[model samples]
Target: MKILVVFVVMVLFCDCVMTKECTNTPTQLSSHTYRYALLNSKNKTLKQEVLTLSSHDHDHLTPTDDSAWASLLPRKVLKQEDEFSWMMMYRQMKNNNGGSGKVRDSGSFLNEVFLGDVRLDSDSIHGQAQQTNLEYLMLLDGDNLVWSFRKTAGLPTPGVAYGGWESPNQELRGHFVGHYLSATAMMWASTGNDTLKKKMTAVVSALGECQEKMGTGYLSAFPSEFFDRFEAVQPVWAPYYTIHKIMAGLVDQYVFAGNDQALKMVTQMADYFYKRVQNVITKYTIERHWRSLNEETGGMNDVMYRLYTITGNANHLLLAHLFDKPCFLGLLAIKADELSGFHANTHIPIVVGAQRRYEVTGDPLYKEIGTFFMETVNSSHS
Candidate 1:
């Protein structure tokens, strides 16, 4: 009888695991489905809720007055802004005319000005660029681009070597590669340098190959197990911090150098990231592991938001929302100065993410939160 009971218990356990695996699969939304969902009744209700919340007189209202809140209803449609670009410049031209001093012309009030190739054809700028390019070339090796990825995957390190700040012993071993990619891509764009463009392409290709070898859409100098350690509140360096840099670098390459491969790799990595985090972390779990976030995670939220804007992928938008640190942001929302002993660099990225969220979603709460945080930081920390 005891042996029979044991067999039944094992069978039940296996069945439970299988059921969970089946349920964990993410729903794949077709483009048409995504658009339909965006325009559906559910989204309209959400928009109404956002508007009501934004216009609510929170100071005068009591928490128990649900009827009062419901009576406020909703009004106004939100406007969407264009994706931010550094090259796009805008300045408000003051009108000195006698007629009410208000600029009537669309070109007079605020206008976009094109600054044509400021980085090119200037001797001083070219000299500085040449010096920086020389230093970058000295610091990096085209062949060793895959060294860290190889090491993480338990494979052999190939040709040349990573040294200086990106040496294997360094805590930030994988960070410089991302920074290098961004710098090279921007330099190529500014000066139309074929050599720089070629180098950027090679590095991106090598990284893509590394990602393929990992076989899980995961690419990093360290394994995904680091995130497990992070969730467990065990001692580990900032894995997401490193990941943000890599994602940002790839995005820069795609945007500036027009490298499609970089975009593909980043989207793949983002999918893997979303699945892992959604499966592992929940609001309750994140609250429980709040102390783990004391370490820097960089601007994971900011980059994810940018990715969403680029691809219009709901998954990326969801990922961005998930990275919000409620403990910090909650305080900021209430205009509390809770940043007394916080790491300035670590928290600043989160505030910037809030600002980006405001721009993308047109949510006034995010704008308020971001503005409050920025004001507090400028007044206190600055």
Candidate 2:
């Protein structure tokens, strides 16, 4: 009887993971994932009925009812600015006079200009949409990215070896590969284009194979040694960042494609990382890892949050918070913005995690820091 019961449960589990096809086109998508992310102020209000799912899962909260408290933003800081490539690309707004000018305050006003007052579905984007901009983005992002790494772009170093493409900017290759994977994942989720879906599936497959070949359970378009250096407490570049992109892409695939292999691929990567980098250290472990850690590896825990949501694996969620770099965040704890000339994308998203945490934990300070950082970076960086 027990054996029969186990078999019945197995059959049901298999049924849940079945490979479902996504047929939603761009036109059809206006109602689904597009609408999910493109929610207007009204829809956002409806989403507020919520409470915490966990530290990692989304909080169903929204700013409503006069924001639960009155607040004032520092007026002077609103005009301070910082520069980043992508945010600058979007700040082409012109006032009545056509005299050329840049609206200086990037970090302060960015939130209002982009996430708020300016809508993602604005006619401005549709009217000026050119293939070149999107194509450039497509080329500029992802692991083993062909366009930027093509001999025309540069020469092959690591992951760009696929299809004989080369990239002079070796540092750009890893993160771009990861970003392209994410973009492809987003493109797949948004459009359900069968051709692109197939292409992305193949890309994940090749990446998974490369990961397996290294025997370390981690995978990248670059040398496996990056992970080794990271785990061994040696100096390294953005391993956690690249891993986050790849895992986020996989989770996105599971969300959109319901792909089994993609799910497995991400699980393996997480397992490797969780063991090597996350709390596997001894209490009296070396000083190098203890001190330099907050500098390089922070987002491993954030990705675990998403993976936990996807696989219902509690461990993934637990591990995501393990690398909480409190010092940089201590600045957030105090609402500081001496945050110039450092890693922009890394810290920005980490602040976002704090925002999510506030909603789940009902911690007001998290709200204060997240909102402040978001406002600061939006105005200054964007």
User: What's every prediction's RMSD, in angstroms?
Assistant: 18.2, 23.6
lDDT of each: 0.61, 0.47
Write one digit per residue (lDDT tens) for candidate 2, span 1-382: 6544543453354442211111101111112222223222243332232111111121111112222111111335324342232123212211111112111222432242211122233255552453233444444323445333233223332453433112333422345565556666655554445766676776666665566556666665555566665555343445676667767767666765676777888898888766765443554343333343433343555566556646655556545545444445545544566555444444566766655444333345656777777787788866
Question: What TM-score number comes out for model 2?
Answer: 0.54
TM-scores, each model vs. reference: 0.66, 0.54
In TM-score terms, which candidate is top? 1
Query: Per-residue lDDT tens digits of candidate 1, residues 1-382?
Result: 6544543453354332211001122111111122223223244554344224322211222112333222222212111232111012111001122112121233323443322244544567776776677467645676686587678867777775577545565445677788887777767766676766777798888888888888888888777887887665443456787888899999889888889999999999999988877665564453334444544578888898888778878788778876765556655654566665455556779889877776666555667889898788789867
- Segments of candidate 1 deviating more than 4 angstroms: 1-117, 125-139, 154-156, 282-291
| Candidate 2 Cα deviation (angstroms), residue 193 | 2.0
**Model 1 quality (TM-score):** 0.66
